[model samples]
Target chain A: MILDLHNHSIKSDDGRARVESYCQWIRKKEIPIDGFVLTEHRQYDDESDYRALEDEFGLRILKGSEVETEYGHVLVFGVNDDLRAAFDFTRIDLPLATVLEESGRCGAQAVPCHPGRPNVGLCAHYETRGVPEGVEIIEVASGGSRAGEDEAAAALAERHDYAGVGGSDAHIVSHIGRCATRFPREIRDEEDLVAALREGGFEAVRWT
Target chain B: MMVEFGDEFEFQPDVSMPTVKSFTTEATRMDFWRFTDHEKARELGGLPGAIVPGIMSQGILAAAIHRFLPGSTIRKIDTIFRAPLLVDSSPTARGVVTHVDEEEGTAEIDLTLVNEAGETPVLGTAVVEVARAE
Candidate 1:
C-alpha cells in the first residue's frame, strides 16, 4: 500500500487546504496512491472523522501530528492517549529524548521530518547533540523540500543507518502525492502502519 | 464612490524594510523562523528571503481598498493566503468590481496581491460600503 505519510489540512496554523479539497484534487489529478495521513501541526484530533470522505474517494485517511521538539519537527504516528498525556504536543520545545521513548512505549512512531531543513531539521541538531536515542525512522523524501534538502536528509539517514520514509508534507491541495511511502503489505489502520514501519519492508518513492 | 461592475484598480503598498521588521516584532508570540531569518528561511524552504507575515499582506489589501474607495467602509473582507510574500518584494494589490448594488451603495470586489515573482500570495473577496454619490 502506498500512502502519503505526511500532510496538513486547515487544522494546521499554516496549512490552507481543506480535507475534502485534498481528496478531490488527488482524484482529479489521478494521483495513484492508497491514501494519506493528515499530520496537523502541534495537535492530533482523535475526534476527526473522515470515513465518509475516505469511502467516497476510495482513500484511507489517517490522523497524526507534526510537533516541534528540541531536535526539530517530528511526525508522530499511531498517537494514543498515553503519548498525548506523556507529552504536551502544543509546546514548541518538547524534550526529544522523552518524546522518542514515550512514543515507543505508546507503540507510536516518532520520525523526524524534513531532517535536512535548517533550524527545525535533525541535521542541524546533530551538529550539536549527535543522534538522539531510539530514532529509528526519518523522513528522507519530503515534497516540500527545496533542491538539495532531500538529498541532505537521505545522506543523514544513510549515515545513521536509519530507516527512511517519504511524505508530501503538503499544506495545499495540489501537493498531496508528490512523495509517498510504499508498504509491502496492506495497512488498514494506524496500528497496521506502525507495525509495517516496525517490520521494515517499505521504500520512499517520489510520486510526482 | 460609484464603483461600477467590472471596474478595476491597482495599488502597491510600501512594504518597506522597517514595515516588515516592525510587523515581525509585533507578531512575537507567533514567531516562525522563516519570517525574520534570511539564511534560515532559504536553508529551511529555499525561500528567496524572509517572508512578510500573511496577516500583513491581508492588511495591505485592506489599506488598498480604503485608498481606492476613500469613503468606503469595509463590511467584510475574506482572505486566502496562497503563498509566502518575500520581504521587500513588490506585490501589487488588484481589485476588480464584481457586483455593485446601486440601491445599497455596496460593491463586491475580487482581490489579488501578486508579488514580483508573479505569484498571487493573497487572494480574496471583499464587501465594501461605498458612499452614495452626490
Candidate 2:
C-alpha cells in the first residue's frame, strides 16, 4: 500500500487547494496509492470532505490534525471528532511531552512533522533525546524543496531506527503525490497504517 | 562641508506604527513551515502557540521604517527574539530613529515588537540607506 502521510488541504490557514481538487488530480495522474491522509493545520475542519472524497475515489482516507505544540508540530491521527472540538488551537502553554501524551489519550499517534528546516519548528531536543514511544514516524518530505533538512531528517530516522515517512505536505493541487511512502503490506484501516509505519516496512518515493 | 557628529542631525521615534492585523492579514500565512510552528514556538519561549514568522515581523518593521525614512531601503536588520509572538496576539511594530548620518546617507533605527501586555517580543537594530530627494 502507498500512503501520502503528510498533506494539507484548503482547510489549513495557509493551504491553497481543496480536497476535491486534489482528488481529481490524483485520478488524472493515475497515481498508485491506496490511501492518502489529510493533515490539515491549526485544526481539523475537513472530515466530511475527506470522507466524501475517500468514498468516491476508493481510497483510504485518514483524518488527522497537525497540532501546534510549543516544542514543535505533532501530527495527531485517530482522534475522535468530539475530542478535536475541545482542542485549544490557540493555546501554546503545553509542553511537547504533554502534547504527545494528550494525542495518545485521544487515540492518536503523535508523529513529529519536519524536524529540520532552519528556524522552523523543529524539536531539536526531542531528536537528541531519542525517539519517544507512541511516536510512529518522522516526516521526510515537505513541499517540493528537497533541501538538506529532509536529508538530515532521513539520516536521523535511520540512526534512531524509526519509521521514516514522506509526504508532499502539499497545500496546493500541484503538490499532491509529489512525495509519498509505499508500504509492502496491505493497509485496511488506520491501525494497519500505523503498524506499517512503526515496523519500518515502507519506502519513501518522490514522483515527478 | 561637514559639521559636528551630534549636531548635524536629529533622531526621533517614528510616530507611525504597523498593527499586527496589517502584517498577518497582508503577508503570506505560514503553514507547516518549520520555523513557524505553533508548538515549537512556545518551547522557544514564544507566548503564542505558533511563532510569527520572523520574516513577517521583519516586513512590518520595514513598513514602519518606510514611513519616516522615505525612499530608504533596509540594508540589513539584526533581531534577537526575546519573546515569541503568539497566534492571534496583537503586536505592533515600534521604531525609534536613533541616528541620522547625512554625509553617509544613512539612518540607524531601533525596532521592537510590543504586544498587548506591553511586552517586547523582539528587539533589534536596523540600518537604512536613504536616497535623499534630488
Please, what is the whole-model Cα lDDT of each candidate in the order they appear? 0.84, 0.63
Write one digit per residue (lDDT tens) for candidate 2, span B42-98: 566444475566776666677777765667789978665655665556676776544
Q: What is model 2's C-alpha RMSD? A: 16.7
Q: Fraction of reference contacts reproduced per prediction?
A: 0.00, 0.00
Clashes of each: 0, 15
Positional deviation of residue B44's Cα in model 2 after best superposition, in angstroms: 24
Which pairs, if any, clash in model 1? Answer: none
TM-score of 1: 0.67
Residue range A53-129, candidate 1, lDDT tens digits: 99999999999899999989999999999999998999999988988999999999999999988788898899798
Interface RMSD of structure candidate 1 (Å): 8.3
Q: lDDT tens string, model 1, B1-134?
A: 48765577898877766677777677544467677777888999688788888778888888889888988899998787756777778889888665667878898776778777544667776889997766
Name the 10 consecutive residues with the lowest summed lDDT in model 2 chain A: A117-126
What tens-digit string does per-residue lDDT give for candidate 2 at A1-208?
8888888765776565556656766776688777788887767654365566788988877767777665567666665654565567545444567666676665566677776554334546555555455455767665433246677677767777657677777654545787788888887766666566656667777774
Docking quality class, candidate 2: incorrect
TM-score of each: 0.67, 0.55
